[model samples]
Target: MLKIRNLSASIDGKMILKGINLDVNAGEVHAIMGPNGSGKSTLAAVLTGRNLYEITEGQVTYLGKDLLTMAPEDRARAGIFLGFQYPIEIPGVSMANFMRTAVNEIRKFKGQQPMNASDFMKLIREKIALVEIDTKLINRSVNEGFSGGEKKKNEIFQMAMLEPMLSILDETDSGLDIDALKIVANGVNMLKRPDNASIVITHYQRLLDYIVPDFVHILYDGRIVKSAGKELAVELEAKGYDWIKNHDGDE
Candidate 1:
């Protein structure tokens, strides 16, 4: 559903992503593993058009559309969901209100009528259950005073509500306890469909245990240097990133 070729990006006049090439088809899960500063998150930011990173070269096509030309909100409406590595708190905005507005906006973009209050409430309740989020939290401000796990789960909850065609989950496993990790992974697994895909970016292999990937890609120095199966995650864990670093040679 998404194709990228020789994609490079930079921020503050300094280059980050040198050349990234990836193609994600429906019903597939791709895991990107790498050490710190390897541009995993940078790739996500570039795809989502975060406004800081400037695309210096290459192209990204999503569902046959020029994804780079669209605004970030338009991209979200086009079914691109980005689960942030560090979800920021938006105080004074109730989760219900925040999500209701977002959903309605997306609906408008699709030329559909806005969901009624009653229907939106029902939908939110059902989706919150899918992520095992507490209803009490919904009434509170978005990510306000929430723990790390709660923020990550909230991101998944938003993902469930939006039902994106391609989900970019960047370090969704970070700062999460085992229980929280399992809950997040289970939600992602349940949301998987034949017409959607996911790109999971993580440092540790533990997350892969719960959400098995069809392809495991080792992203180093802003480029995907190695691509393998799920077994690659296990090897990375046992051998560490240095093993790949020493052998692969720097760009």
Candidate 2:
């Protein structure tokens, strides 16, 4: 569903993501692992059209369309979702109101009419159950005063509502306790289907225990040096990233 070729991106004048080539077909989960500043987040930013990183080379094709040409909003409406590492707080805006506006706007993009309040509330209730979000949480301001786990769960709740075909979760496991981790992972797994794919960007191997990616990639310095099955995550957990750096070859 997504294909990238020799992708290179940079911010300001500094280069990051030297040359990344990856392909994700429908019904597959891909995990990207690397140390700090290895361009894991940068890849997500570039893919989502964050506007800071400029693509100097290569191209991305999403669902047979030129993904780089689409605006960020267009990408989202086109079934692209990026779950942020640090979910920002939107004070004074209740999640219900915020999501209602967002849902209507996306519907507008899709040439659909806005949903009535009755329908909107019913849909919200159903999605809230999908993520096991509390009634009080959705009525509060978006992520405002939420704990780390609450914020993360809210992100997945948004993902469930958006129903994106390609979900790029950048370090979704960060700061999550075991219970929160399981909840978020279960939400993600529930959203997975034969027609959708996910890119999980993470550091440690623990997250993989729940998500269980079909392919694991070692991204170093900017390029993906190796790609392997799920066992690669276990090996990395045992031997550390230095082992992959020393044996940088396709596995």
Whole-model lDDT per candidate: 0.94, 0.92
State the lDDT of candidate 2 residue by residue for 102-164, as single tens digits. 888889988999999999988888888877778799889999999888889999999988888
What are the clash counts of all predictions, listed in order?
0, 0
CA lDDT for candidate 1:
0.94
| Candidate 2 least-lDDT 10 residues | 242-251
Once superposed on the true structure, which residue ranges of model 1 sit more than 4 Å away at CA? 249-251
Error of 2 at 123 (Å): 1.5
Report the error of model 1 at residue 36, Å. 0.4
TM-score of 2: 0.97
| TM-scores of all candidate predictions against the true structure | 0.97, 0.97
Model 2 misplacement above 4 A: 249-251
Best by TM-score: 1
lDDT of 2: 0.92
RMSD of 1: 1.2
- The deviation in Å at residue 48 for candidate 1 is 0.4
